[model samples]
Target: MKIILISLITLVSLVSCSNNSQVVSPKLDPLNQQFISEDELFRLVLHMDKLDYRSDEKIQLHSTLEYIGTEKKATIWHGMPYINYLITDGKDFSVGGVVSTILKSTTLEKGEVYTFPYIKTGAFSENDPNADFWREFFDEKDLYLPPGRYTLTVYCGFSLTEDVVNSKYNNKVEVEITVD
Candidate 1:
């Protein structure tokens, strides 16, 4: 009995010592909007390494879109890429499943434009929107506001490897934007 108790204690100590540290840091908002503030024509570029594509098909990196129409429209749009979306109620936010995009083997820059196109879930009608904002992905549309200051969050997972399928990565960003 004494030997068994000693062995049990030793096993417990070994288990405690092997914590298997998994450092999950809080997400950092690093949106590179150094030049344009409100209604300026600009583009967005997102980087992806093959592993981030959780889709049934192999995801692609390096894509573009004509999001910024003109300097006065205050319009930016991208097709949904992920499954999480959020709606804001002043201070807090309402979360939902929405459209989001994934990238692999790519880099984002100021001069790049990314476009995502989606049809609104409801039936097509004069009163229907061409696309669903938060219903698809977490973009500006889900926030639902008139014109004010707000913060936008994007969650990205990444992985880079000689065989991208074997690498691992996570990338997310938040942006300070104005409604108009």
Candidate 2:
């Protein structure tokens, strides 16, 4: 009887431990403006005002990083622009901005959130081969996306510490949009 009781307690403990280690899926906002990706230490959310737009409309994009680990605080080391955006038509058209090479760090406590916005400067040179195509798609005066479907991916490139790891993390979330 004593042996049976000990076995049952051990089995119950094992089951509870396994349950605690199970992966949890990221939750989404009801309105769909926020798309989420997560890991054991953090949660990244990509935010777009809407999923549909006109050919001449200006799209606003940003991302947020939230510390979700059990630790009191976590430090992330990355480039000047920790988070960046990549917009692609999945064919011939793609647009992304250059990021500064300067290193930076940010620390966050559990449940704290940090925001990063998409920013671009300068325009394509007129002498470039794709100058005409780029002019039609965007200009220095205003930014617009041509009429088509696009996949916008927001990625946060960082490492847990300043020390070089075997591989750094580029956590990203992709969402599709349409322009009439």
Candidate 3:
């Protein structure tokens, strides 16, 4: 009787464990950002937000115009770093998943510039535990504006990223940027 009882208990435990199933989102891990090389070319990256999206297709590309400090934590502390920002189709594809950002920025001594490449793919699941770095940046932002021209204007209107910003976005200067 003891042996039979033990077998029954084990079978019940296995059945209970087998019945558990859940869907979870992946996490957006941060990228290991570094200088790809010395002569890397950088262009201006603009996020598609706060304006008329003149394009019919979704997904716009953008870059962050960051202000650099002499002794900041996230920078080499030489000059301002302009990062490539992307305003993806996240809004229309809410049912879709998170997008990862592999942004890179380098500053030239005489030019005001920033650039990054955007590869818009599926979104990440919060429960996915193994989402990539770019995915983390993608999952953080809840809103993705339509295709249009806009400005950085102080890391989204506040000084949250000021330590990483160089004296550019604070003026709320909206330059003419277009998306297709």
- Deviating ranges (above 4 Å) for candidate 3: 1-58, 64-108, 119-123, 126-180
TM-scores for every predicted model: 0.26, 0.71, 0.24
Candidate 3, position 111, lDDT: 45
In order of TM-score, best first, we have 2, 1, 3
Q: Give the per-residue lDDT of model 1 (tens digit) for 18-72.
A: 4322111233232333222222333333322322222233222222222254333
lDDT of 2: 0.69
Candidate 3 weakest ten by summed lDDT: 75-84
RMSD of each: 19.9, 19.8, 17.3
Q: How does candidate 1 score on lDDT?
A: 0.32
Per residue, candidate 3 scores C-alpha lDDT tens digits across 54-145 of 45543343333333433332222211122212233323322221211112233233243333333332334434454454355455444343
Please count the clashing residue pairs in each candidate, in the order shown. Answer: 24, 0, 29
Winning model by lDDT: 2
